[model samples]
Target: MKPLYRGLASATRRKASRFALETRLDAMTTRLKDVGEFGLIERIRRLLPGAPDVDVIVGIGDDVAVLETGGGSYLLATCDCQVEGVHFLWDTTTPFELGRKAAAVNLSDIAAMGGAPRWALVSLMAPQEILVESIEELYRGLGGALAEAGAVVVGGNTAKSSEGLIVDITLLGRVAPEHLLTRSGARPGDVAAVTGTLGDARAGLELWLRPESGVPEEEARTVKRRYTSPQARLLEGQCLGRCGAVHAMLDVSDGLLSDLRHMCEASGVGVELEVERVPVSPALPAVAAALKADALAWALTGGEDYELLFAVSEKDFPRVADQLLQETGTTCRAIGRFVDRDQGLRLILEDGRRSSFDAYAGGWDHFKAT
Candidate 1:
């Protein structure tokens, strides 16, 4: 207890030092009412500057920052948002974790597009109760995730709000024009593939929401870690992009079924998802069984896995899977295939039962919150 208290005290002092000179005048008093939205944004913009060496035609001051890049490369852009209650629980999630989530979610979108994330703009809206130190920690998390994805946080807006916190990230990247992959590229007979396992993050979220499920300490911590820190499949996506096998790609932000439906709809095709072929994280079954939850449903509907879901030509499936495993150490497997448009999106159960799956929960809609 003594050592823990000492460490916490030291952390508090360090946090204070980190913001020694950046105090807002109304911070200690009633909420910063005088600092208008634009004033707060200007303060944040002043603190965050653009990266050196990047060609900047238009930076931060306009409606959208435009960039001049060498021709022959395709432009890839993705936007994602994280909200307090919907995406995270304030009591369980750290500021640093929140920041990483903000960035990684957007980077996952870039990965889904089969591009390398080059830059990001992070816009944050939070209640006045959030401390300056926490905000800095959030940026640190964002920086760490950006570094991992080979992206830079160029600029963004930050302002106080009485409502719940929100972090919106827009990521921009480039890939060889020929290498660009979108959800609209899947075709009949194309093989469906996924990077890494699914359901781990969903299991983690369940553990987080209900801690009394009798999970062992180590297992519980692992689940909690997955919920807090999900890695974007940037390297895997890049490798797949270079492999010339990927056709259509998307991040599994919603459950596998939902995201797959998205790709199918966009591509003007239908898909047959094999239940047995879907890879479940090793921890998923045990955790779900203990909680009396359906593991398959969890994997099918779980969000925040951040894994890449892609389609490839049938002839390229084996080679693509081999290269992806060798290059990124992430497992890639064919889960299904694109079928005729009339077949629609169908899920084949283990018992050989088939049914159409229509998921109501789209990818993180704020207005649909319970």
Candidate 2:
């Protein structure tokens, strides 16, 4: 870790430039982009802290970091990135909100795996002109959310970005080998349950992005909070792990239907979602009514809700829900049940009609060209 700091000068050496660089023939120079993706990753690996001696198996260089406790559990680690204009619009979202959201989203992934988060590493790519005060405030906001989620910030990196603010959060969590939930474990007859209401964040996004609309200040503030600082159901996820009831799990970062379909496809099962069973946010309906948008559609297809969805055995459903309430004060409701692979993914409407729903596309894919 001491040697890692030696490369800090490389990050801070360059001054902001108005024109592209075209240096003298023999001068040593390298554009940040010219560092190349692999080289930049090597630099980041060099900068990260070494894993503690007691529990780490692999760290800093894999697609996902790993740590073994030798207690029949292994820690699985991963991170997520939120970029301004791409993941969000800074003008529409407050720095405090953005910070909380960036951290919350990563924690949500950990929760989706039925794991309890233990550590976090945040990296911010700040623009040259943003105020130092704003940056400090953002950390305060993120710190609050991380505390609430039962995780700690162990390390971070800061650098300048010419585009917009960038927040990348890495999370480390521990899960018992027998209790770890993954998309590939679902089986026919397993029941699907979600921890909370959905679509509020997506509806909130619409409200925050459009200011000319006549929404009340208090309502606006609430929606903005949801869009900016949504919480991850980490406690509930831990309860699910303790209950030993979950088979497959995933966070609803993308649309609910899309992510659910992902779990089913991964596990080689099909799902039948009861539309009436999908929890609706109390605030979403009113906001959607004002905007002439369909609340149900928003709840079904909206992303960034950060809720946990998991499949459980029908026999363990009652015990699981009761444990969740006792531990998290959040109800875990069954929304559907898994079916045979050949049956395929389908949705049951409130009117008692059923239809097949296939994906045209789902979630944010950064590599796609506009």
Candidate 3:
């Protein structure tokens, strides 16, 4: 384990900070548009904390940082940022809901590890025109969600942004050594499962993005609320982690296909997911139909539902799914199976087609054209 000291450079280590006004740069710097989000992340992984460091059980990747502080359990640190235009919009989401969703995403990361969230640090960057009452409501929503998970906000920072509002939260959690689960544990033949229904958030997103879709008022209300406020499966994740049946786990912020790809890459395995089993939310089909969109597509490639996705062995999945339902009152679905790394990511369509289809680009990429 690597010490946290090297995770960040010393304030005195350099005469100017990384964000110094007059920072120097190389002769040629590629634009972020060319590198893309994951590419930029890979470039950063090479420059930062150099994993295999002392006291750093996990670093630079996976959803959270698993640290060894000589404590009873490993410390889990994760953060997520919500931007106004990118994550939420004032036209559809209230400040309170925005705040709640921001906190929930980070909570989902901790939940993925089956860890207990203990604390949070929320930093906000907003423009001057924002109202104080809205911000207060936002914190009220954020603090409320944290309280539900036995976590609290210790402190954070506030800065004025020339652009849109940004709410970034860093959450810390703890997981006993025996209960810790990462994305790298799935073995071939393991069953891939997900908690709760999928695609509701995206349906909700569409309510705002495609107003002319004519989604009924009742259905419209349902999906929009889900999009505005996502619940993190903290209790379900903890139960699954302790059950000893789950092989690998993560939250579905990046959609089923994309996150499955992540799980496969991390576990050095591959996956084959069934189209019929993807667990589309009940609220999705009607909305998708109204919008003339594909509900299955939303279930596969839509992001930000905050559901937990895990892999369990074929023999254990039934028991694990049953126990999870009984313990947390949350339904779990086994939608896919892990395969050899050589198989890559394969999907089964309703017509009994298995493919690594070139046209079905997996999931959302910040830098890639959709």
Candidate 4:
């Protein structure tokens, strides 16, 4: 009887010890918000299934995945997601604009890869109480944007959610192997350049957010139009990719500095940005003046511009810039130049003074504190 009682006590002790260990582990586990968006993505990338197949040329880290399709062509695939409160305000934008924005975002990813969009698959999630007509309007907008890019939606999935509307689009595109532009190809001497203007979208959004801020009505409308209906540089991307002069290419969906850092990281190089050279639309200055904000700050950190930022070889930059302007009707300006990694990332201020870029090392992080 004594031996049996001792055995039961030992079993209970072991069970309690196991529970305590598990409780400590649960307490130690970090939350998603603590890690932030990029950190979470890095963890996901590490956990992803092993080495990709032979046909997979570019994988997780790029804007779009490049897969060999044979016949000297590669398939570019990318997906983007937009949530109601996070991406846009429902009251400020129509369903048509929302749909268009959704489609355009994914198309921009393909454009970043120098590919022509061909097909798309959309997935929508909305509450059951949502209006059917609103959904139809959204689809109409998506269709129009896709048509502009010569792409058609083949299929998609729909589901019911308890929260606000959600949209996800996956775009498929094709590009010649030689015309493929990636973030990893920029060398030390490449010129850093961008298309169209920067910060207009951000300025537009600010005006919309603060209508009483005394911004001109017409300028507000123009900037708001830019924010609502952003343009993807499809033609410019294709031209630059095929030109063989551009070394690295990406779209400025994130802030210019953030995206530039991405390119530098991938290429294992550094960049020096001439602050004054970053272009701003005519409307941006007015908006900045009214709001008492620095337009250059917006140009550096404002996002969702959907403009192309690429690095061109020094020898070919002049010709490439001229050809790009002629072919695409978009102004391509050399804003900076790539440098050896040891130089690190630097910003040349308007006063001709150099500053460490760490001060501006911030952008739209999904999990970052608002």
The candidate that wins on lDDT is 4
Identify the leading candidate in terms of TM-score.
Answer: 4
TM-score of each model, paired residue for residue: 0.78, 0.79, 0.90, 0.92
Task: Give one clash count per candidate, in the order shown.
Answer: 0, 0, 9, 0
Whole-model Cα lDDT per candidate? 0.78, 0.79, 0.88, 0.90
Residue-wise C-alpha lDDT for candidate 2, range 27-134, written one tens digit per residue: 577655566544676788788876557665545533345577676778889888988878988677677877888888888878876777888899988888999988
1-370 per-residue lDDT for model 1 (tens digits):
1335444554465444434444654366522345543355557678996566465543442222334467867556667788887678778789999898888887787776667889888888888787889889999999998988889989888766558888888888887766666677899999998888887888988898898998777767776777788888888888887888788888887778878877887788999989799998667788887899888777788877888899999998999899988988888878999999999888888899887776424343333324
- lDDT for 107 in candidate 1 is 78
lDDT of 3 by residue, 1-370 (tens): 3446545766745665565433356436566667887888899988775546688887876999999987699999999999888877799888998888888999999999999999999999989898999999999999999999999999999877768999999999999978989988999999999999999988998888887787788888888877888999999989988999888999999887888888888899998889899887677999999988899888888888899999899999999989998999999888988999998888888899888834476777788644
Clashing pairs in 2: none
Could you give the candidate ranking by lDDT, starting with the highest?
A: 4, 3, 2, 1
Candidate 2, 308: how far from true, in Å? 1.0
Model 3: runs farther than 4 Å from truth? Answer: 1-29, 49-51
Worst 10 residues of 3 by lDDT: 19-28
Give the C-alpha miss distance for residue 249 in model 1, angstroms: 0.7
Candidate 4 regions with alpha-carbon error over 4 angstroms: 1-25
Clash count, candidate 4: 0
Instruction: Compare candidates 2 and 4 on lDDT and give the better one.
Output: 4
Steric clash count of candidate 1: 0
